[model samples]
Target: MRGPAEAEAEDFVAAHTAIARPALVPEIPLHLATEITPIWQATEAWLGEQGIEPPFWAFAWPGSQALARWVLDDPSRVAGRRVLDFAAGGGLAAIACARAGAAVVEAAEIDPLAHAATRLNARLNGVAVAEAPGDVVGAPCRWDTVLAGDVCYEAPMTNHILPWLRGLAAAGARVILADPGRAYVPRGGLAEVARFRVPVTRELEDRDERVVVLSRLLG
Candidate 1:
């Protein structure tokens, strides 16, 4: 049975977005906003009226696209392993991990709307991804593999998350970070494992295509 928060999120997402496939990972379809500004305004209006945070989960980011493609192309990376998709907006990487045969998959997102989106996307892809809300950073690493997408966009978030991710890597958990050349992505510690030319909307990325890289943290 769905909880109240989940039901409310589902209703909000259904009212604001449309089901569409990301350009880079066309195999998986997701519910996404077609117009960026309108959705942002809508979410902002909702925030003013109902005190809800802006819905960043209603978009498929380039890093996630690259990560999802990499996972599908090389399923052995996550196959039969317990996986955690950190900051799992839209649950793209989580769904990919599940499809790649991960023994267990969990998506961690702080936003209730994102949790709803993850649940909906997992169901759409015919996979199971347990949605965990709230900050999971610095927690004891339980998964065999951890996947993070576009997490370095903000300096504060980068500072808070990178160390925890590196700790997990050091502890022998495979830590894969998909980054779109964000300013905060560390110059060292991460080695580029794969790269992809991800097509993205100009409104979101300010460019037609972004070269996203899948980097593995050196333990």
Candidate 2:
């Protein structure tokens, strides 16, 4: 589950290209990959630099980097496709899609702040992005693929996203969700495609590294 600190960091992102820290700050932040840069803080700083904060959700918890690992392993899934990053937070999955050669990518998030953060992070990572307001699932969209990461940590989001995802699938959109065994993960026909052991923190306890990956329904 994503923690409060992470949410706060996202809430504080800037809209300019560079940001100055106003205080020492008190949130324990985690970095992406084997780097020392805290992803949450970096995202906030990036947003601060940009100088814009859009409306966003309180806790669109992104699971432990599961989506990143998969994109690095097999980058072609996004190549030359129009992709949607549903409920995108910090735009990690969207960044992965951009890196994978997606023709066009959009970060569809509900929160104005999170949407701001997502755009900031995407730009920092040199990823191009388009923004779709509110929960983008039921809205009219044109996408070849849809990706979700760590959006199932709550019952409400699950209830809303699940049926919408299934509906997208039924409409011939290639959809994939990345999770690390989150509590609300549904028991359906989802088949694990890959897994990883990601380091977690105190707020996310009982984790012996997160097993992360994309899933497919196996009949």
Candidate 3:
């Protein structure tokens, strides 16, 4: 059952974005903003008028694109395992996990709009991704594998979540993070697994292509 907030989110997304395939991960389609500046401005206006945060859910960041592509190319990493996609913006990695045959998949995001977009995108990909709302950082880990993409972009956010992610790794849960040369990604404690040259919108990333790396946390 969908709540009123979720329904409102869906409606707002439908109004503001379009269903299209991202270049790096073209296998799955997502509802994304076609013009970054227009969407950002609109989101800002909405935030001032109606108290909505900027819709990060409408763009497929380079890290997420690489992560999703890697997962799809190598299903064995998540197949038959319970998977959690932390801070699952737009749920691209979660959908990849499901499509790759994960036994169970959950996408955790703090924004209601992201939750709604994730559900909608999962449905578009013909998969089921359970939405775990609210902040799940520092929460007990139950999933066999956890995926994080583009989470180190902000200094404060990186500082707050890295330790919790390290805790998950220390506890023996496989923690994989994808980063596109973010300023805050640590210089150590990671084992490089894969890399991708992801195509991205310049309006969002300021470059046409980004080199994204998928790394496993050293436990």
Candidate 3 TM-score to native: 0.95
**Model 3: runs farther than 4 Å from truth?**
45-53
Question: lDDT of all the models against the reference?
Answer: 0.88, 0.61, 0.88
* Candidate 3 residue-wise lDDT, 1-219, digit = tens: 888877877887778889999898898999999876777677667555554555789988888888899999989989999999998989999999999999999999997778888988998899999987579998988889999999998999999999999999999899999999989998899999999999887678778889998999876
Separate clash counts for every candidate: 0, 22, 0
Please give the lDDT score at residue 106 for candidate 2. 87
* Candidate 2, poorest ten consecutive residues by summed lDDT: 21-30
- Give per-model CA RMSD: 1.6, 9.2, 1.6
**Backbone clash total, candidate 2:** 22
Assess every candidate by TM-score: 0.95, 0.70, 0.95
Of 2 and 3, the candidate ranking higher by lDDT: 3
Q: Write the per-residue lDDT of candidate 2 for residues 98-217, one digit (tens) a residue.
A: 878889988886656656566556655677878776667677548888887776778987988788787777777777778877788788868777666566543434654555656752
Q: List, residue by residue over 75-182, the lDDT tens digit for candidate 1.
A: 998999999999888899999999999999999998877888888888889999997657899888899999899999889999998889999999989898998988
Worst 10 residues of 3 by lDDT: 45-54
